[model samples]
Target chain A: MSHTTLQKKKLIARVSRLKGQMEAVERALEAERPCGEILQLLASVRGALTGLTGEVLDDHLREHVLNAEDDAARAEAVEEISEVLRTYIR
Target chain B: MSHTTLQKKKLIARVSRLKGQMEAVERALEAERPCGEILQLLASVRGALTGLTGEVLDDHLREHVLNAEDDAARAEAVEEISEVLRTYIR
Candidate 1:
């Protein structure tokens, strides 16, 4: 299997957990929970997201950047990751 | 009503939408969609999250920092927000 396909199960699991966290935030807001609690939840979600992003990025670097078949392909891979990172960090 | 309470409905709406976006990512990953598509979805989710965080922070600034009753309270509010921001930006 391709590297990405191999990682699919784990990645999906992380996304499912993230969905649950988002749902909890929604429920907390609907129930008029305190701002402090809500902010705490948001912080946790943000952390989880960062973690997921890092994992995906690591995989991308391995499959695309590091394993590129040629210099041209490596450059393209670098640009793609750079573009995504630009959008992501903003 | 307090500022946070006043914004609860809108905030919840945003959270619900975020939940939906996250669900899409989960589905995409499960179906083994292309990595590019998954990254795009992830980026959009991240953007939505940043927007939500900004809205909550705005309300926090208005209700807690700007309208704080005294110097001590203001200091505490500043510290609280700073702590959250530090964790968030990490």
Candidate 2:
């Protein structure tokens, strides 16, 4: 039961099945489907929400950044993770 | 450039920087820093990666999933997505 409470119950059962696949992709766009089968169900819900955001960023980089210790707080936590990866690769 | 190309570029850049942070973390450990500092760096890295992942997922959802047309295709897509989510959350 540990392991972060089993990863928060598997991220709340995969976000409740991704909210039932976004309500079945809005009921296949109100039943007027076609566009390549709704873009393959929106690429399988964007690959299942990018695998649930990479499993919560790989469990926050293995339990808070690989078990940090110090050196200016790991260079200020890698410069605040490079400013959040430069604002998410913007 | 095309959106996909731009996304690729951003991903590459972010990954490269993440690599640098990894090296820095290693150095911090080698220097026998403190635990708190190291953890911070790791957290930052995780945040950055998560942001990047979200960006990609959002783009995919917008361009591929949300714009789909058909019914069965959409259903299949959603199912595939569910599978992915299950794997990741597990």
Candidate 3:
């Protein structure tokens, strides 16, 4: 099985929680919650997303980069990860 | 109106898109898509979430900090924002 498939259940759970968090933020906005409270909620969601990203990135490195079959394949995987990271952090 | 309320529709639209992007990521994982493709989807979600965070943070600065009623209130708002940012980037 692929690295992501190995951890699929756990990853999906995290994504579910993130969806809930975003919904909460939406409701808070609908109710006109204070900026401070909303900011706190947003920060929590941001932190959670970052955690999920790190997990998936780790899996990608293991499955695609580290375990790649050849030097050229490894280099290609590295480039793919770099592109994703660039978009992520840009 | 509060800063967030002023932009509530726009903000909620962004959050809805983020939720869709996340759902796409979840679906990709469920289908056991290749790690590289999954990583790209995840990165897009991360980037979208980051953009949403920036919009809300900017609003918070204007509403809670810049327009604070007094020096002490402004200081408190600054601290609150600082705490959120620490968690966000940690």
lDDT of each: 0.80, 0.50, 0.83
What candidate 1 gets wrong by more than 4 Å, as runs, is A69-76, B69-76
Error of 3 at B14 (Å): 1.0
| Candidate 2 residue-wise lDDT, B1-90, digit = tens | 222344544554564565455455455545545434444555554565455545544554554456545666456556644544464454
- Candidate 3 residue-wise lDDT, A1-90, digit = tens: 777888888888888899999999999988988777888888888788878888788877887788987899789889988987787665
- Model 1: how far residue A5 lies from native, Å: 2.0
- Model 3 chain A lDDT-worst window of ten: A81-90
Better of 1 and 2 by lDDT: 1
Clashing pairs in 3: none
> Would you list the rank order by DockQ, best first?
3, 1, 2
Tell me the tens digit of each residue's lDDT in model 2 across A11-84: 54564565465455445545545333433554564566556545554554454455545565446545645554
Worst 10 residues of 2 chain B by lDDT: B1-10
Ranking by lDDT: 3, 1, 2
**Local accuracy of candidate 3 as per-residue lDDT tens digits, B1-90:** 778889889888888898898899889879988777888887888778777788778777887788888899789889888988788665
Better of 2 and 3 by DockQ: 3
